[model samples]
Target: MKTRIFQLLPISAAVACLGFAGQANADQTVRIGHVAPLTGGIAHLGKDNENGARLAVEEINKKGLTINGQKVTLVLDAQDDAADPRQATQVAQKLVDDKVVAVVGHLNSGTTIPASKIYSDAGILQISPSATNPAYTEQGFKTAYRVVATDAQQGPALALYAANTVKAKSVAIVDDATAYGKGLADEFEKKAKSLGLKVLSHDATNDKAVDFRAILTKIKNERPDVIMYGGMDATGGPFAKQARQLALRAKILSGDGVCTEKLSDLAGDATDNVVCSQAGQALEKMPGGADFQKRYTARFNQPIQIYSPFTYDAVYIIVDAMKRANSTDPKKVVAAMPATDYKGVIGETTFDSKGDLKKPVISLYNYKSGKKALLDVVTM
Candidate 1:
């Protein structure tokens, strides 16, 4: 089957079509699919990412993008994968069937990894804003790309902080057992042991599990100085809350999954004990960070959450490839990704041979007064 440079508009673009009513009909509707868990426990973060992509699409459409001498209206074809691998592939297949030129997510690495194969087979471009698993881009798939630093980098930085700054002699680890969770925890564990921290225990939990009393009780008995969780905010938040209820004094440490604005609400008063790392610089520290935050809040009526800045930059990165190719075809845009060096809200955006961002920064953060506060930054 021959793919078109612009496919038929999907129902996801129905709202975008409404904006075309008063304006001249667009010469072509360029659809970009976005998939994330919009209906699950981490919906807030997923919705934030979607909103960022929507903001970029809306802005691009307003300015009217031109490619190959044709004015194109960018249409956002958003889908919900519920952060499940099975649903991720289904969503990926749907986007492929809809013939979108590219995709913006599958926020979880578990989802992103499986969905990437589908995109690769279809020759479509995929740029994840938050998926940090090194295996994602390591699968030798040209379609796989991520703007954030990988677990390989994030894990060592977090472990260094725990062993040096926090000065923890012993630590207990818990993971949700998903690809992202296990991979990150394993990396941390490896580095932590090398730093001479005693590994008290290692436990496993489910990503969907809210009650962590069993794991928390077991961890408490171990008397570790630090309790690190490898999972998203959904479970990580509740895990901290339950640990507090159990009177566990060990500080809670986690990777990017558990780091977000929503963690404070979910963890309640327990949020103060949590320290987490994000794969990039804090939004306020980015190049156009302040201005982007102002505009995002004005448009969304809320503060920016995790991945919004990266997703916003991801959209621009995709557009940059399109402009360089002078075409909206996924093949051409994908072929042009390697040569990209676009500057956007994030600092200089460039990718390595493996499709991972070059010169990525890891920003560690802690919550203070029910808000995420920057703790430190390490560039890799």
Candidate 2:
């Protein structure tokens, strides 16, 4: 009788172990990749984007996730591309190899454009929170999508503001020579010309360039009414500062890349001479902007830079697709993205055939007393 009882105990123990194993198998971890320039001149902006995604991941996990009736945990696999195109591709490949279900970023157009191919090849959905280059979506990569308006929309808006609002008849164009900068400059130049604004001169400067005196001197000589700089704040700020120091009274107009809260510090008092366009609505105007700002500040102990709200929405958008697809598989998620109509912190987001926002908003900003002031919001 004792031997029979011991045999039954062993069988019961085996059944308990099988139950534990089955429960473990029912729980799955879904990896989502987020890439940005975490260690560079624009690292602050990159960190902001990453923090937004991280915050969303934490919130989603806390709320609990279930896909196909199985419990799931979301993990954010953040990577740094340093805003470099080459490094971005490398990071993209690594994420692909790591089998991330989807990706949230590659902030700069230069990096996003190059890295997008890798994501496309891997059949993973890639959403850019801040990359505004129109080419990012025009590449025919079904995997590429952006939460922000494209440069196509932003450039013309900036050009229209420069021509009508600033009352500028002539403008000089300068680009950082990267995919984002050059593309935006080109679009602005085309629209500026169509609007009957004379293009005084167009020049190219590398993204890493700090000394814009040579170019500014050349532009100053031309004496255009507005100096349109298509670059990030890292270069645009100093460019405006030097232009002011050189006594160039022309207002500096730029795209979303130069539109940030940190621009005030980088450009100092000269920020007043700058007018920039953002590819999204102003934070105050967003549906959940105020609450998001409060939560983001509390979590990161820092102010939102530019694209954090968009990044936050990007993560939610991805999860929304996953839920609709009822699968964490990248291919299934991509299939569900086209039907996305999720309302998030940034607002209602829907994609066109090209994966660009169906209805996009562009906001114009200027600095007054070293503070960013919203000038106008344009919808297209």
Candidate 3:
């Protein structure tokens, strides 16, 4: 049998000996879990998330970290949740079964929120780099965390920019009806009302629905200055297109959910003058953003999105916590996480008592020529 031989020495002398073989074996494996919609409606987002997480692991292992005095290698356990909550739950349970000490994923709040409870129950630390629903952390789960600011933050900022900067006197609110979409819509409506902007209409649409002609017609009649959408690019794109088709002259405003190159493709000519407030700034804003974008483009042969940088930060947080705790034991790393304040690619990251990021930044952007250009930094 292959045996880990430190040195053939007396039992008393072996106390000082290093078990080289066992160290090598143990050092070559550090498992982390990720769940995202790898092959569903939001596959583009999932692909970006998985690639970002993978890149972080690559960078970490390249640095050659030592844990418990043994060289550590990162191993990812990825699952396709398909942007479905039930599937996300299954994946979370699977990760717990596999005994992953940490996880970074479930891009959508709908999926992340449900899966988070499972991770909390299992004592696994879960950090969502993109899920922004305020309720995700409000569940009082000690193990749940997010790198992005909540929708509550993004919603008000977007509404304020619309009423103040965009000079809108009246606005219409539309949501995809999911937890993420509806929550953002509610916050935006509340803020817009407080800002003295008349709410022309509030509507809900299924994510899979493409025909928004009926709703667009009503919005056109209301003559709102802007129509704000609380949903991802998948639905936001169609809404923009239908608005233009129905000759609705209202300017479009959306939250981070609609901030993607895919939105322009979905909006086509309707993309012009569309404003959005994202969780963070553009690639140029991050200290490492330019380099990361260059490397990410080189590796993936495509442009990166807003959430990827946060996901990169999430992976590093896990690694840093492991190093601080000096062990991969889930409990130790979890305890050490609060003390972590690492300068990651996404900027200075630190969490609050509720596991939400503290002082997270938001940025406004205007979509032009199939790309989102940063307009201004929106502060709390």
| Model number with the top TM-score | 2
Mind giving the per-residue lDDT tens digits that candidate 2 earns over 184-211? 9999999999999999899999889999
How many pairs of residues collide in each model? 0, 0, 0
Instruction: Give candidate 3 misplaced runs (Cα > 4 Å).
Output: 1-25
Q: Please provide, for model 1 over 1-380, each residue's C-alpha lDDT reduced to its tens digit, 9 standing for 90 to 100.
A: 23442344455376677776535444888899999899988888899999999999989899889887778888899999999899999999999999999999979999999999999999999999999989999999988899999999999998999999889999999999999999999999999999999999989999999789987888888999998899999999899999999999988999998898889888998999999999998988999999988889999999888888888888889999999999898999999999989898888988899999889999999999879999999998
Clash pairs for candidate 3: none
Which of candidates 1 and 2 reaches a greater TM-score?
2
Global CA lDDT computed for model 3: 0.85
lDDT (Cα atoms) of all candidates against the true structure: 0.91, 0.94, 0.85
Write down the TM-score for model 1: 0.92
Superposed model 1: Cα runs more than 4 Å off: 1-26
Between candidates 1 and 2, which one is better according to lDDT?
Answer: 2
Sorted by lDDT, highest first, which candidate order results?
A: 2, 1, 3
- lDDT by residue for model 3 over 20-59, one digit each (tens)? 5555556547789988888866788888888889988888
